[model samples]
Target: MIAAGTASMGRAATPGPSRWPRAIVRLRLALRSSEAAARGGGGGRWAACFRPAPVAGAAAAAVKEAKGERSAEVEVEPARGGGEDVWSARADAEVAQGGGFPEHLVVMVNGLVGSADDWKFAAEQFVRRMPDKVIVHRSQCNSATQTFDGVDLMGERLANEVLSVVKQRSGVKKISFVAHSLGGLVARYAIGRLYEPNNRRASSAGKSRDDVEHLEGLIAGLEPMNFITFASPHLGSSGNKQARFLLLFYEHMTFKSLPFLCGLPFLERRASETAHLIVGRTGKHLFLTDNDDGRRPLLLRMVDDSGDLQFRSALRSFKRRVAYANANFDHMVGWRTSSIRRQHELPKHRLLVRDEKYPHIVYVEKEVTNNRDTEARADLYDPEEEMIRGLTQVPWERVDVSFQKSTQRLVAHNTIQVKSYWLNSDGADVINHMMDHFIV
Candidate 1:
């Protein structure tokens, strides 16, 4: 017993130094485990604070690499109204594109029951692709149910919102609009309100043709550039006879817009009668049923310059006007209305080609019309015909998109804009096409 006790004491005294190293190692491993657990949200609240923060540049690069996007670093700041502005740093933009920081303001408007988030993908793509030439602002003023308001009220709201944005960003010298669905109509109405002739009449008394063209003036005192719409009902949402006949047999249809009624005669007629009950004043406007104040429908009045609202002139001020329409499966908006064409004007299906770069872009047509040929016809009683004639006065580049072969064809309206990246990734090419062809 005495020998055993003495041996234990001897060993305890001699190996104390070695034992200390083992103890320290055990402690370190315990701490690491706790840290890992805390990171995984298992336990140990304070362990997260011990971790080092990732370097900003490295983190951003990692994200870009993971997403396979070569987009430059951008900053997003809250702007007036419910919108947010996206722009890259001047140094980064110049380094990436060898150009000055963007001076153009691109307003992105959302559609029915939509918010600023609807344009998130497109807005980001715009800033990423044209970092040196454009700042994208996603509009949120007339979002969600607010879109149910009549076009005039929404237009006024949008105009005020835009003016607020302009006042906040005095550095912006150019303006453009990118809208979807109902937002297109809202944008049109807003521009009409924002248009200033620069005393065009006073300056045109003795000016040359060239000089008069130059005096076309500005939108909100800023030079207008591209005005683009995606799946917008430019000719209103009333269904045409051809579309109704084609969709007459589809029984499992959903309520999207007027055209989504599957072209059934009874459904279309019933929808026209009760559209206002569902979407409020905006529905009335879309169906051409709003005859408030004993006047023609608001959509009809918007086709021409009425009183101070120079609707056509405002459109003419822009350098480019584009309409992106879904040829099929966009039940929400009819191709004819979205494309601003008559039944006979639609391009043949055989003409559609799949470009390697833009697989979904089926066709593109640029319509050029002489000013004399597009003079507003006041005598025309057919509202749809009048609108088609009125808007075609300014040349439009119509881009036809078809998801006819895609798994996501059913939601072509949302897909065309990549409204939600994960769900609508198939529409990415359309956005890429827009970015590739976008004018600075």
Candidate 2:
């Protein structure tokens, strides 16, 4: 799942003298300086980095006005040979003057060990396909070595990155998230944080319930649109016996006891005691065994309703919630986990027949299990159903995509993104169709 690192965010303050030696701090600062120079000193702030011009003619004028710019009226050109541009059709519908076409911002988050660069092709395609209607931003704040941090910590950083962008762009009135693999969990936690009321005291103002509500309302006003993920272990890896075993192995080898003896020297950095620290914590969380605080699993807390009004409000505000799972060749995440469904709920087959309309995709509707049914099986706890019962109450549409071994050699975990060769071959259109639900 490791990909090239994109530009890093501003480094956090160095540890105190007791935590780090001056020599190491200096070396780290130098390395960061060179990395910034290579990335063209992009200022390490969350900004709208892509704004492709709208299609030629009247649409151009609309785009300018959409940006709050006044311009002379331009005659719209008729479709040549009575053919419309496929890409232009994907843009937002036109609006009358002063009606104001609210711009939608799509935030794409990469999985563990992945970077913003991984979304380069996907972002470009979205811009090229949707033009002025949508803007895509890739978050690389918690990638690479940084991914070794816990999900809650990463989620806090991502929340800041998103809030920074939202603060900078006043025109953006709606937001959507497209995350992959572990990024989905991070995004979930971040959104929960965003929904919560701001507790920081306002300058020259007293803290009150009204002020807190207003702060939360500001985020809610953004109009969360779509929450989508690809190959995300929503039910987590601990739901199954096999997955649990593998997670146990991974935890012991990386973070539990003998990570150094795992023979993965490349994962160790002198500045950071173990490069695997972040991954180990992440694994433990996913395995539902990282109860350091004596609380429930992180995933459970994420879906719980009591005392999480903000989280429930955020979840209810989203217009759509969807997940894409791989039917085969996805050894990292299983179908049930990625789909957030119970094993007994899905078909007993390895692969279903290809979908007719979306030949590359298979759609699975969530099985609604009645609470009474759960009462009879009290011995077993259905995490999937429990999540649905939570305040978030997500109604997920699980899509399963096929991966042919004869055509592709590697697993499908990483290929869910748009840039994958497998997706580019014939699956791009299908993926685009899936994304259409969020375009408007």
Candidate 3:
């Protein structure tokens, strides 16, 4: 029951040229030729080369040949006639229907050091529970490669990846994003890029305005559906007193090798550099500590009025936006940061009650204590303080879930998408609750 286009849970292929069969290569050439012909006034020459007149006995063989030697893991729709790719035709039909696209496209983004495989379990569950038409694509951003790069760079890459996905799945008019941890930030950054307004109204002679308009139309046409994050540090970890030490400890534990002075010497060096950058400028943005320039914190810039208006508009466009916070045993992102609320604002009491509406899930919601009501202490001027004020103004739902002590000990930050946890009763409940947000 794995969703369509879900990447294999094994290692990702190293970035390189894809080895293709002779027939497949020819097929691509034919497609390209057809596309070029379409752009010109001439009719498709390669179309006839690939697809000959249908003869009774040979038609079946032609169909088989067209199927090619594709792997079972990959789903490939047969090329339909009329010199147009099936996806393009489907997209055109969808546009004609005026209902936007009938199919739901869900993109699952993994956190730091996580590959597309991290979402395999969740994708399977989503496919099994959701409608058959839903297609889930697990995004591979800073997974196989270096994740130490800045969030902005990752965000730009993600934006390009998403655009590529959109182009490939032309019929996908609506999209829902499910991101984990740092992936949430990447997703946010991508959406911001997609929603950036065309400030330069007048297009240059070389760059036609129509091109810009078309690109803008394509982005706007993709109706953003649900946006859900698991254990994302929305409010950031910088403000959390415990986060600094935890991050350092986690880094040490991850990279420390007995043979080397600090573990793998090269890895340790990279980790040290990452830690410095993360705790300094990057950490400041994530934690809303220091505004590097006059600009506010990264999160505030993502959704504030003065920041990117189009980004804020795109965020508001989502039908449902939810952040699921781990109440216990999450060392990476704290519950307060995940919930985008202040640390002291959470309810002191821990009440575990099964939701009547969602029987499988147990959750707790705490009323937000407005920090703005309190007088601002006279302190050094920090632009982050202003950003935090703006962030608190924007209201969002936060659900708290706590796991059993044993589960907490075994499965902390990784509990969100791990297959074993999803199989467990409590984990199933959590998954059910998460899926509910995507419904409709």
In candidate 3, what are the lDDT values of residues 1-440, reduced to their tens digit?
11111121111112234643444345445546544653564536654442323446733432233224222222223222101111223333445777454367777887765666566556655654553446677776566333445466777777777777766667666677888877887787777676534444223212456644533222334656677888777655554433422142232223210010112233333432234343333444554544556765566676553444355555655666677777765656777777766547664545556566644234655333234754566776634355445545534566776654432222345655442322122344466677766654
Total clashes, candidate 3? 1
| Residue-wise C-alpha lDDT for candidate 1, range 1-440, written one tens digit per residue | 32343243235334455554553344344446444664575535433322223346644553342234634466778987658988766635475676555779999998877788888777776776676788888898997667768789999998998999888977677899999988999999999999878675333233344644564667877778889999888888775533232221121122221123332355466667655545567878987889999998999989888889989899988888999999998867789999998787899999999888899999999755534444446776667877888888889999999998775575577789877553455787898888777777
Local accuracy of candidate 2 as per-residue lDDT tens digits, 207-276 = 3556544332334336567888888877666543223212222322232211111222232222122212
Query: Model 3 Cα displacement at 142 (Å)?
Result: 1.9
Leading candidate by lDDT: 1
Model 3 RMSD in Å is 17.1
Q: Which ten residues in a row have the lowest lDDT in candidate 1?
A: 248-257
Clashing pairs in 3: 257-263
What TM-score would you give candidate 1 relative to the actual structure?
A: 0.74
Task: State the TM-score for model 3.
Answer: 0.61
Cα lDDT for residue 26, model 2? 45
On lDDT, the stronger of 2 and 3 is 2
What's the lDDT for all of these models? Answer: 0.72, 0.54, 0.52
User: Model 1: residues >4 Å from true position, as ranges?
Assistant: 1-72, 90-101, 200-215, 241-267, 370-381
Of the two candidates 1 and 3, the one with more favorable lDDT, higher being better, is 1
Task: Give the distance in Å from residue 322's predicted Cα in candidate 1 to where it truly belongs.
Answer: 0.3
